[model samples]
Target: MEFLGIWIAAFLTLCIYSFLYRDNPFYRFAEHLLVGMSVGYIIILTIYFGLIPYAWDPIQKAVTGEASRWGFLTLIPICIGLLFFTRLSTRHAWLIRYPIAILMGVTSGIMIPNALQTDIFAQVQGTLNPFSVIGTLSSFEIFGAILIVIGVICTLTYFFFSVEHRGPIAGISKVGITFLMIGFGSAFGNTVMGRVALLIQRVDFLINDWIGTIF
Candidate 1:
């Protein structure tokens, strides 16, 4: 069974890789299979771990007097969730907007403060305290911290469009542009490296596990 599983995985891996040559039925089959399996797995998890445990079980417990009567309140959100299916019917599609608006309002309310705290305030705090390492850290560490401070300032300056881009502001913004390019290049390189790592793993599996098993 282990060998059978390995062989199946190897075949699917090759099927996906075959897309490098050209599109074909094998690649399509593998793609669809992966998507179908992923969706099926998510649905199962949602039913067992989410809906049954949180919604149905609570309602059952409430009925049996095993839990608080407030468990019936779960029906409100369940009905709201059911509203999402209204999108499939042209006449009742407008009802979906209510749930969507509620979702957006709640999500934004929850996320706005967290975003401000983590993204804006945290970044400002970090940038402001770059020199905090000066007394305790090595020169290289201090230089790195200074570099980070400079990068953050310049990057922020580049996005500032209030004043015209001339003279010192222009020069700093140009430095910001350079920093942006370097950041983007590093990100691209990292992504390429990740893909290369996956390729290496697949190739290693094909050569070692599949071929070695056959031999």
Candidate 2:
């Protein structure tokens, strides 16, 4: 069984890597199989790990008088979940909006404060430093901080559509564009590095584990 699994994995890996040469049926088959398996596994996990443990068990306990009234509250989410199935019916598809709205409202209510704190407050706090650090900051640190502050101001100014980009505004906007380019380049480099790392891992696995087993 283990050897069979290893051969299957190796075959699938080769199938996927075939895409590097050109698009082929082997790659497409592997990709579709992976996606279908992922979706099926997720559905199974949701039924067993999520619905069964949280909703089904609680409702069963409530019905059996093994749990308190609190257990009955689990039925609320179960009903909401059932509403998703209504989407299969053309006439009842509109009902899906209720669950979607409930989810959106709850998620937005939960995430708004967190987003403000992390994206806004935390960033502002990070960008600002006390002048008291004058003695602690090296010349390089001071220069870097000034550059960051300038970059931020220029970037913000670039977004100001009220004034036309002329003279000083043009110069500032150019600086802003430079900073944006640098940020984008860094992000692309990181993405490439991540993919390279994944490729390296797969190659290592094929060389050390999979092929070694055969030998």
Candidate 3:
């Protein structure tokens, strides 16, 4: 059963990979199968994981009267969730804004503290190294760290339009762009290699399992 399942996965995987050639009935069938299976699984999981734990079990406990929970707060989230369906209605569409605004406000509030903590405070913390250090950790490491800090500052300056740039600022901006492009290029290369690794893994599975040998 395990081997059969493995081969079936490989065959469908090839069907998905056929998109590299061109789209056809096989790709369409595989795509539809993926979508259908994902939706069915999500629905089943919603009932098993979400509804059972949050809704059904609570209601069951409430019915037994041994549990003194009021279940009123649960109704609030349910009602807010239903407000999403208000998109279909022309009359009460304004009701959807309440939940949307609430979500946006909550998200913005959460993100502000997290962003400052992670991005700003973390960068400042990393830059607090003392000037003096020992043998192997020579002046080169300090120079490299200084270059990184300069890169970050100049890159941020390139985006600032509060003042005009001409001589030294323009030179710094050019350096910033060059540093940014090099960093971005390296990141993109790493991302491509990771994706290629995943492709190789899937292809290896197909060859070893489906073909019964790597040929």
* Estimated TM-score for each candidate: 0.88, 0.88, 0.83
Which structure among the candidates has the greatest lDDT?
A: 1
Which segments of candidate 3 are over 4 A away from where they belong? 130-137, 161-166, 213-215
1 versus 3: better TM-score goes to: 1
lDDT of 2 by residue, 13-72 (tens): 999999999999999999999999999999999999998998889989989999886899
Instruction: Give the clashing residue pairs of candidate 1, or none.
Output: none
Error of 2 at 183 (Å): 1.3
lDDT of candidate model 3 versus the reference: 0.81
lDDT for residue 187 in candidate 1, whole number 0-100: 100
Candidate 1 Cα misplacement greater than 4 A, ranges: 137-140, 161-168
Give candidate 2 regions above 4 Å deviation. 130-132, 159-170
Q: Provide the global lDDT of candidate 1 against the true structure.
A: 0.93
Which residue pairs does candidate 3 place in steric collision?
Answer: none
- Worst ten in a row by lDDT for model 2: 125-134
Model 3 CA lDDT for position 172: 83
TM-score attained by model 2: 0.88
